[model samples]
Target: MNNVDEDNALVNFEDDQADDLDTSLAVDRFRDAVLYGTDWTVRTLLQQIEQGNIDLSPDFQRRDAWSLRNKSRFIESVALQLPIPQIVLAERKEQRGTYIVLDGKQRLLTLAQFAGDFPDDHPLWDESRKVASLRLSGLRVLTDLNGKTYNDFTSLPDLAQMRTQFDNHTIRSALIRNWPDEDYLYEVFIRLNTGSVRLSPQELRQAMKPGPFTAFLSIKSAESVTIQKILGLSAPDFRMRDVDLLLRLIAFSTRLSVYRGNLKQFLDETHEFYNANWGVEQKGMEGLLKRLEDGLIFLCAAFGNERHVGRRYKGDNFESPLNRAVLDVQIASALDENVRRAVEEGRLDLLGTFQKMSINDQEFAQAVAGTTKSITAIRTRYNSWRAALEGVIGQPVQMPELPNG
Candidate 1:
């Protein structure tokens, strides 16, 4: 959502004004005022940035394209570790109070942009900033859980001077009784975000929700932990969408198959799945999963293949009959001994048997139908079989552990 036009007030400060104003004391006093509503200080914001958890949403910063030079500036600031720019916020008198961002989008974005562990060679890297911005580069500021602690700022301890300066550096919010038009806000978001590091549509969605499911995944194709770990998550990886799919796969496979609709529906249903009989079923599945893991390790030992299979399947390993059928099935099965028996008795042959298994479930059927269009029908059918086998094993494994709250 855009809100540029909705923000009816704007404050323009020239470098001269900033240079002349003794803002330290005023900043200190205004700290309390700012804290009352936003409750964020330079310390807290920086801490979140270092933690790579700041909310760079429409409410915080606009979506925009960021050039390498812009990224370098951000990296320079991080390397210098300077205090993040002060944000001026105001409250709106709507149904519930809403906070408005008054200034500091560029500086705030610089913090949010480079906060993540971007590759070392990228222009935005902290090390690069150090090498490039030699003078300001060496100065590193300390960050707290609330705001930034600057040696330069704190060095000036004149209380009266600081107080007077803070008063002079006035930052306030303006609210409206009637809500601004949605189009105005949208335009604001776009205009502010244009020509900067713009957020994607999916990223925007994640910001709106900002919950467990939403919080779980929010990276671009350039960086997908799921692709790195999960078997078969390929390039052009659908970052959040992939995570959403995985969660759904796990949820549906666990017996919430009836409720697997959109990501939102599955997330809501997950809570109920935990409370229902499936909880016990999932536990059984987990125990079986452990057994299967042990069994796979044993199989690896038997096969003399000692390499680690990361948490999820990926690439050729994902499509491997050995992984998709035997490993996946055995892992999901609740009956360890039964699985062992099956493997010993050629039950592991289920990898090939996947082709023979009937597709009766609606969810699986639809998946097969949809996937077959892109991949071969045979491959889709096999994948469905793989999921079913894994699902069966998963149900009997110890309760499908809900993510730790």
Candidate 2:
């Protein structure tokens, strides 16, 4: 395929929703044990923020995802004594005294930023960085407080009275006490974190889920210098895209054939299975990571800098997404005796063999780079590539068809 075709294919599965749920899959039902904590004043929460009793997992929460308007609107809601959403906290099992935010982080963060020196991102945050001079924007019902900061009161009595009211404003809170494990917490977070806007799959996974697998992914993603370079990503991706990519790798490498149409659903399914069987699957998961590294080494040896990965094309648009889709399939299908042995020995003459397969095998290209989610595309590519790879390496091997996408 030409660059134009590759470009089109680069968008493979951009908005692809997996086929409907598989009926045979098990249903997960859970009821969490939660402590409905007593009502809290705004002063109490602000004090907690100052004392660092509330721990916002910096890895997950550092993105300034909320806009300034979002901050202003929320602040106005609190200022007007509106009934705000209850704050949700997961009492950290390890950190005996601290809490990790499970929901309403934006609310807490907005309040903290508002009360302190004005964050330049805020609407009232002028060049001087003073929040005391703040003004409310888009205040509908509380128009009297508009264009006035806490320090803008002309009368001392009025200022003290308003300050007392603001400080005494109540914030209801719920505590997820005594979570059995990180897995349960993660599930709860996923269930509640969705508001009008949804959280990303990876973000949901990391929020409260504690497990060997997710923990390992977090550690590996942060330390994966080589993996990041191979996949053409910046190391220590704060947004956790690399971690998301890792999940996709694990999902596709192990579960490609059974892939229902929806990527998120497939991932959620994978998450449930892994969390349930992590003790048994941990060794195998490690092996998959090793094989992935081997696969990347093989690809770089075979394709050099033209990895067909990354967002921007060196000679093509970012095929990182496409490259991942293809690579996962290839690794999972590497059951052929010859291919397996080559990978085991670390001496696969990948460049010569890949070139020959590309030249002599037209179907190979189509299968590798066609419509990404078609069953035909999934089945034909793996089978054809296996055949071509084996032929160039000299073997006729039998392998199962790749599962549905």
Best lDDT among the predictions, by candidate number: 2
Q: Write the residue-wise lDDT of candidate 1 on 330-390 in tens digits.
A: 2343234544465565545433333334335444334332222222332343345446555
Q: Candidate 2 at residue 217, lDDT?
A: 79
How many residue pairs of model 2 clash at the backbone?
8
In the range 203-260, model 2's lDDT, one tens digit per residue, is: 6566546566776777766666555565444444434556776787777767766775
True-structure Cα RMSD, model 2 = 10.4
lDDT of 1: 0.35
Cα lDDT listed for each candidate: 0.35, 0.58
Q: Which one wins on TM-score?
A: 2
What TM-score number comes out for model 1? 0.34
Per-model TM against the reference: 0.34, 0.51
**Ten contiguous residues minimizing lDDT sum, candidate 1:** 8-17
Worst 10 residues of 2 by lDDT: 1-10
Candidate 2 stretches greater than 4 Å from native: 1-55, 58-200, 208-210, 309-322, 333-337, 340-371, 396-401
